[model samples]
Target: MEFTRPLPAYLVTRYHGWKATTYAENHAWYRRLADEGQRPRAMVISCCDSRVHVTSIFGADQGEFFIHRNIANLVPTYEPDGNHHGTSAALEYAVTALKVAHVIVLGHSNCGGVQGCLDMCQGRAPELEETSSFVGRWMDILKPGFEAVKDDPDMPRALEHEAVRVSLRNLMTFPFVKEAVEKGTLSLHGLWTDIGEGGLMHIDRRSGQFTVV
Candidate 1:
């Protein structure tokens, strides 16, 4: 259980580089942010995959976005069970406290979490079905999404897009989120990133199709 350790040399060197460059150049902005607190315009829920860089994609500066990264970027249905729920907690804080104007679910092509869900649903990954499996339970949130694309010839890709759709649907399940949307105080969006192509696709809710943005 011991946690004390030195950071790897590469990461430490990178941190020093950032400190000397971006941090130094934006020291005043960082101080202002610390003093005034964050008032991000949007809340982005994206995958934990290192390849998906939300800030880089949007060219957003520090404190411009309230970002939450999780496996598959999945948002579970609203469940007030008095248990720990990281994604739900972040959503609540962002919608109720931060008053962010927009909430975006950012999924990506070649998402490992989506692929895992596909594998589990197809009986290819029994390990994920075990009750003790953390990833299995977390990905269970996307079961309905996987079902929507299970029969497709391109299940992985389809499920990736569906993950965004599923998250948007789940966001509405939260009473606070729904109220904000109904009141026109908040908006929801679904987006999928093509990692290899360096392109972005926004879901057309009306058409249920991903159109290039």
Candidate 2:
């Protein structure tokens, strides 16, 4: 197959610049990573939003995190019917293969996917109701979360936090994840960040409340 399109010029320039500067500065480190392979300690499931930088937030290095980005950072319940499952695949590799010690579901303020879910739940986004809309189908995973916080004064923010809880609950549905947790080899955490204020919150597993971190 012949591809007609070419990569954007600015990206090409940036790639060359990174190769000359950052990569050159860290040549030995990059070589070690390439030779040793990745041994990330944590698997961070975060949003696809451009604003939420998981590495920057944690001050993590290139090989420190196995990051997975998805709409609303949602994790669907385990369904191994032989169909395509991107997030599940990532989770399996992270838990069973990589043996990550921690799995963090990172939600953020002003999430577009969460807002879309709210709109769809409120009967506002008619297009999202269609079966053909991929985003709509994905957002369906968060509908239960919406139900829990639909009446909140700040439904969007509430649902954002609910998204993390929903994903954390869903993460347990995977047998490997559950087994790892039961074996004391793995732990799960839920976190939310305020994009505008650069604030962070951690969910208390016992009380299910998000407290400032």
Candidate 3:
């Protein structure tokens, strides 16, 4: 499936502009971080959707947050499969090596991956005939959220928010995260960003609440 416009050429051209501006504007900060051996204090686990730009959405600085992205903003339970688990591996590094204070699962509205999972949960979508496709397996991570909130009238919205919550729940399955959370060294968060409406909600674990930020 190739496009007539061929985006690679446009992207390469854009990179030339970015290289000039970014290097001229921010290379010192990048060098300082390298000189100090610095790492970010937070880790953001977000969806791989192009519309949800985590850095720009949060107004982040260069070294502000360690990022891990995947479809549906998922974090699977710790599994030792032969295949590489990119998101989980990032989590392991962030928790153990980077020693990040906070780990946030950021979900967003109108996520196709979330929609697919909900459709499948409602039996409107089919089971995975090909167990090996990336999205087929990634959407499987949202099942617990659907099972938890399937009957709600706002099942779609609820599923999206609950996916963030359950992925936060799933984050605890990793031993380092579990230990860090228990000792109060690391805190977990569930966040939702509405791209269409332009609002962000933060989960208050203490009150079982989602407050606008």
What are the models' TM-scores?
A: 0.97, 0.98, 0.89
Where does candidate 1 stray beyond 4 Å?
1-3
Model 3, stretches more than 4 Å misplaced? 1-7, 34-38, 127-129
Residue 201's lDDT within candidate 1 is: 96
Between which residue pairs do clashes occur in model 3? none
**All candidates' lDDT scores?**
0.94, 0.96, 0.86
lDDT by residue (8-99, candidate 3, tens digit) is: 88898988898899877988887898898748889999998999998898788878899988888988999978778898899999999989
Give the clashing pairs for model 1.
none
Candidate number of the best TM-score:
2
Q: Is candidate 1 or 3 superior in lDDT?
A: 1
TM-score rank order: 2, 1, 3
When summed lDDT is taken over every stretch of 10 residues in candidate 1, the lowest stretch is: 146-155
Better of 1 and 2 by lDDT: 2
